[model samples]
Target: MKSPLVVLTGLVICCISIPILTSVVSYSNIKQETQTKKNTSSQSSKLEKNEIIKKVINYETVNKETPIINVYNHKLGKVQSMNMEKYLYGVLAGEMSAKFDIEALKAQAVAARTYVSYKQGHKNPSQHKNAVVCTDFKHCQEYKSYEELEKVNGSKWIKNSYSKIKQAVDATKGQIITYNNEPILPLYFSTSSGKTENSEEVFSIKYPYLKSVDSPYDKISPKYTSALKISNKQFVEYLNKSYGDIKLTENNLKNQVKITQLSKGGAVETMKVGNKEIKGTDVRRIFNLNSANFEIDFENSGIDFIVKGYGHGVGMSQWGAEGMAQEGYKYYEILSHYYSQTEIKDTY
Candidate 1:
């Protein structure tokens, strides 16, 4: 019925149409795949940028003006008020300045801030008699007043006797206490008689009427002594002789140490002596005095004296700070002396 030429033309048209349709479908699929890959790449790039931004911003910037809560206990009921700066200073108290990493410090600051903020204005009227028993370290018994401390120990005056504790508390305003930021109670004593076994035993035998019992870890203690022991007169003389040209005054004697100006080392707290900078830990090797000797039995004169703690024997002994605060020293003076230049600014 159909012509041979018509059939041939129809077959040609079919063949042409099939190839064009196939090409269109294939091109469309390829374009779709390309778009998908581009989208995925763009998303990945965005994610990388976000991560970089996060890394760049510090905690202070990210969580600006967040409320700080100082929790008195783990119970979450008793709390005090503080800001991030105050809390961080409290947490980083006594630690060398260089040891602080900003991010890590911020995290700690947040936790302390929360704890203190939660405890604000909590008046439970609980007996101050709840003593902190030191399981890891020995603590002294709590005394109501200086008279009570004297009655128990035979030493009447704790004012000048424990002057370092008072000075540190006065200097820092009680915000920066705690060795390593662990909460500890403060114990007051007339002397350091009950601090060590040897000291306690000797005091007990020497003074039979005195009570040589361990006291709570108060900010005040008998362990307070100078880093380099020269008599007050000798110390002044050393300052006058070493730095006679520079204006010397009793008020500036403590602040006159040029070595304190240097920033804390990355891993080591150091001081500059002459041309050589020395680690605070190593200063004992260069100087020696009978009074400067600590933690060493001088019975053997040849042996090197081993020191117990670091820093000058003034203010909140870092270990003593936590102890005193746990026993309860309001957080103001803690920040004062430890950091000479800084003030406790409210961030919240």
Candidate 2:
């Protein structure tokens, strides 16, 4: 027979062991959570640090090797090859106004360089036969030759503007924005309605770095506010085509033409024109409007459109960048503000 004392002692030991085991498990879980949080924080810190480095990178130290870039000139009817820097001179002169701040010009240079790099990496045979990219924005970019530049900016303003553009291109020689060590599509537009849109929202393709960010300077752009007027009959006719047969009277357009949906960035995602629905881009295309972010109003004689900004409202806004630079922000600052989760790196 076992002693009562011995049995009681054994039970006490079991009780103690149970609590100890529970405490050990709880401690292990706590430790694991702490480690996970630490790892996440460390990762975030690295990303921020990388961005800071990019913001401060010396433009003069960038690689100066003048690479040969093949350009398909639409006017020339043949592939023309020239120094990459020379190509930039024309692109910068065409893309943005030279009257902008120097920092803004530099930002444009980086954007143009990154855009070219992305195109180079994803070379499409269908795009060009003997050229890397073309002189048209539809094919590649808007390349303004010296003569075209003189024509657009005029003989008087061309000299000063051209020099500023050249300075920007020379300063940021071979820099490109990269994400995960790969060239990224540095899409820039004319203006925005205060904020940019995520790539998925505008294009249906989710790009990590192309997420929406607020651009306070966008509203300051000269083209920020524009009005377009059209007859109600024209508006309804376009809607009928989009709807594939919808009966919409002129009265319906005045009473019911409204925005049905909006993207997170405040751009019109879908709008109701009478009984039919259409995308914002469709409205812009049909009427040759300034931007997708617009409001429709019914006037007694015609339909009036109050547009907030210009372009597709995705990626960088050139005027927005210029405004930012004018407000004392640097070139890298403008780039970082527009493109989220991206780093500017030297192409060398």
Candidate 3:
């Protein structure tokens, strides 16, 4: 009874309905897959961030434990494994006067510890291949064992000084001077010439933290001003020793050997020794002057060098630290004053 047109319309409806149902199923599957991918990507990102945070925490805690170090004892000619704190005690004794204020000793301890830490982190120095540091003051920091201290300073000194030194070391257990969250090269000397020398002025490399700063307290140092008298023949010979052809004379020495330039820190930068130019540092080593900040006074018989300060005139001044401590400054304050733009952090 049905017509042929009605039958064709029914077939068309059936085909269209089948395709619509299949499309709906496909859309549902695609939506589920996309959601799953989004969830996975979010988890992966969180994991990546967590891993980065973990790495930073690990680096910060790397030196959380005390480290035993190998020291090349110049006298024994052998490597000695010693506790880090004990080593610091020896360094404090040798590098600084035990009679210094407690705060000054603490500052020296931190400086010494930071210096050794910096050295150990870098490649082993060529001078001491098997050791992290050496006892030779010329190469590394000076060190003296308890026995050596007893021999040099007497038993009474060892008894009184040892406890004081230990208190300083223990009070500041693992503290070190750092710049940019890294250990710094804590170069200290006996005294300064009114102000510390900028790193570039004294050495080839310039450090941001090692800038010239006034050290008014350095005058309190015993070695603040010293005069060395050298005969004319001796002075001329000393100049010629390094330069080979310096034409300096005993008479009119000031005219011939003139200080051509002075550093910002007030040290001689360059001096004209007759026709030859020489560095102030070379002059210091040649004449064994206390520091490069010296004036040459020509006399009838000899030359007088009126020198100010001692050592290299760079970084922390030992006597200056004591002076600051005497002025009621804390160890950290003393350190901050000398090492500009630096922080004290616990390395262990």
Q: How accurate locally, in lDDT, is each candidate?
A: 0.34, 0.84, 0.88
Q: Indicate the residue-level lDDT of 242 in model 1.
A: 49
Candidate 3 per-residue lDDT, tens place, 170-194, comes to: 7787888999988889999998889
Off by over 4 Å in 3: 1-65
Model 3 TM-score on a 0 to 1 scale:
0.80
As a whole number from 0 to 100, the lDDT of residue 152 in candidate 1 is 52
- Tens digits of lDDT, candidate 2, 126-152: 878777888887756788998887876
Residue 144 in candidate 2, Cα distance off native in Å: 1.2
Worst 10 residues of 2 by lDDT: 55-64
| Candidate 3 minimal-lDDT segment of 10 residues | 54-63
Query: Best lDDT goes to which candidate?
Result: 3
Q: What is the lDDT, from 0 to 100, of the residue 65 in candidate 2?
A: 73
Over 4 Å off in model 2, which ranges? 1-56, 59-64, 151-158, 241-244, 254-256
| Model 1: worst 10 consecutive residues (lDDT sum) | 134-143
Q: What does candidate 1 score on TM? A: 0.22
CA displacement after TM-score superposition, residue 164 of candidate 2 (Å): 1.0
